[model samples]
Target chain A: MRRVVITGAGTINALGRDVATTLEAMREGRCGISDLKMRDLERLAIRIGGQVHDYVPEDRWNRQQIALYDRFTQFALIAAEEAIQQSGLSFTGKLAARSGVVLGTAGGGLSTSDENYRTVYEEGKNRVHPFIVPKLMNNAAASHVSMEHNLKGPTFTVATACASSNHAMGQAFHMIRSGMSDVMLTGGSEAMLCFGGLKAWEGLRVMSKDACRPFSLNRNGMVQGEGAAMFVFEDYDHAKARGAEILAEVIGFAMTSDAADIVMPSKQGAARAIQGAMTDAQLNSDDVGYINAHGTGTAANDKTECAAVADVFGHHADDLMISSTKSMHGHLIGGTGAVELLACIMALRDGVIAPTIGYEEPDPECALDVVPNEARDAKVDVVLSNAFAFGGLNAVLALRKFA
Target chain B: MTVRDKVIAIIAEQAVLEPSDVTGDSSLEDLGIDSMGLVESIFAIEEAFDISVPFNANDPSESDFDISSVDAIVAAVEKLKAEQA
Candidate 1:
């Protein structure tokens, strides 16, 4: 099998607008959850979310681009611009035909759907916009990314709720390793902070009204976040041949389904995915030094994730550092795993373990060594990022420091 | 419509049966109603009575509304309607 390496990374999330700013925010343990600024706030019982209040689309795109690009697709383009620029590889000729773009998002164009629905239903309109179908499709982001970057091979999208990005990136890695593509633009984006989006989630009753406190005794629930993270996954030889800078090596990836519950997380299922990733990477428990947890700040996820990690690592679990960036950046849902992958890169590249902020008191159920409230400096060669979504889908990725 | 009659009518519609064929003791599973049917039944009931049901699909045991049997669901709905009154 061929080796896959991440050549460049870019992100615009609740934490920061770029990879550097995001890593710095993690280093400082900054909390991004605040008062949501979306429409119809009074109707929502959950008032707070991890919204990107600083994002102004007009600053980046003009009237024409804005009309064609939905908010989610806009995020994908912005992140892709930084990632493609950082990679320093111009896609043309053979490279253009072989490269691909795969993105993940549960709500592709929720803002568009929400706006049009209100116009037709509430306003009692007889007609709708002409570009509604293209803007609201699940593959819209991926399609636009491919067109923008001249990538013409194997473009698609994934929509597995919270696990979407991990699954997307995992498929990208497999594609490069199997010689289907030499380079791929892979990550995720989400823009579900509209009134309709929040209202639907409100019915689920799994959201925190005030804050996100992952792995804490006083934790209420997960907080919704919106943004995107894009990365360039290239074949190891292709990157090295061009003298492209290597960020981290994608060594292993595994996905598993519980097939048990629709909403509730399964510990055994999560454990299998964790173990599978480690096994696929040919690394033992001792080699891994850090874990970016799936911790959604809900009562069920934190406890279940901690149990799964403990079960997978055994005695090594206590020594390895685990933290949830969600407590700082909030849960991005479909786009979450892509953003959390930034944490693993930070650990493997900078030896910095991002802290799980908002931790007040430790619960007995989650007794692992969670770096809480403060970032820690340590030597980390291997790291794992976990994403367990709703509907019992779990995906885990293992990364190793490039030698 | 009475709670029992309305509830049975929704369930029977999902099951493709006459309302008279459905009994208060009939379990949702026995009536061949799946989760999708259950959600549709709940929506139909909500629209029919304009009453919200406090059902937790994740943990039905903890929810105030009962979906164990048709009779239990009727009792729960009547209680919610009374509380609203």
Candidate 2:
């Protein structure tokens, strides 16, 4: 089996518009969440989010392209351009035929749907935009990425709620490892901070109005975020042959279903995924130095994730530095794992562990070293990014420092 | 129907029990009402009474709206109605 390595990484999140700015924010423990400025903000109980400010589409795209692209698709395209450019590989001939795009998005073109629903139902309009269906489809981002890059291989989108990005990235990794593809463009994007989206989430009552205080005793719930992060996963041999800059090696990936509850997370299921990833990578528990936790700040998720870590790592769980960047960037739902993976890369590559900001009082249930409120510099050989969705789907990816 | 009766009716529907089987002192747990059920019940109460309840499903105990028992939920709904009025 061929080994996989990430040659390029790019992102546009609440913390920053590109990879460098985002890592800098993570290093500084800066909080990007603020009072959300969107249409019909008064109707939402959860008023704050990690919204990307001043993201005007006209500045980036032409009118015809804007007509075809939704906000999520636009974010994906922007990130993909940065990632593909950084990879320094043009998709043509055999490369173009073997390369693919796999993206994850839970609420694709939700803003478009929300507006059109208001137009027809609320305003009693008889017609809608002609490109509504194409723009709102879940695979729109993946399709657009493939088309722009001229990738003709296996291309699709994965939607497993919050675990979407991890699942999509994991599949991309396998596709390369199994010799189905030599390179894959993989990541996720979400732009769900609209009136209808927030309204639906508000019904569940799992959103924090003030802040996302992950693993804190005073933590209320998760805060929604919006953005995209994309990466180029290439075969190690392929990257080495081209002398491409290696970001990190995709060593292992594992996904599991709780089959227990739709909303509540299961510790055993999460533990299994963690253990499975380590086992797949042939890495011992002691080898992992940092973990990007799926800490949504909800009362259910943090405790359950901590318990799973404890169960999987045992005594090493105490020594392992785990942090949730979600507290800084907020929860992007489907797009979250892709953004959080940047923290893991930072840990393995730069030896900087992203801090879980907004951490106030520590919860007894989550007593592990969360690297709270301050970034830590430590040489780490391996790291894991964990994503557990609302549907009891858990995906974990293991990465190793490139030698 | 009275506020208590309406609250009991909503709880019964969530628990899939008869209104006659529900009592003021009965806890939601005793009636097999899960977290999702509680959220639906809260929404039903909000729509029925036309008052917003300050509740967070992540930590029900931390929420200002009491949900300890049928009587507590009814009392909390009454307080919200009075405050909103």
Candidate 1 C-alpha error for residue A296, in Å: 0.7
lDDT of each model, Cα atoms only? 0.89, 0.95
Candidate 1 lDDT, A1-403, residue by residue in tens: 9999998898898888899999999999998889988777887777888888877889988988788788999889988888999999889999999999989899999999999999999999989978989989989999999998899999999999999999999999999999999999999999898899998886766677778888888787788998999999999999999999999999999999999988879999999999999999999999999999999987788899999999999999999999999998888888999999999999988889999999999999999889989999999999999999888999999999987
| Candidate 1, CAPRI quality class derived from DockQ | incorrect
Worst 10 residues of 1 chain A by lDDT: A202-211
Stretches of model 2 off by over 4 angstroms after superposition: none
**Candidate 1: segments with Cα more than 4 A from true spot:** B1-85
How does residue A357 of candidate 1 score in lDDT?
94
In model 2, what lDDT does residue A180 have?
100
Best by DockQ: 2
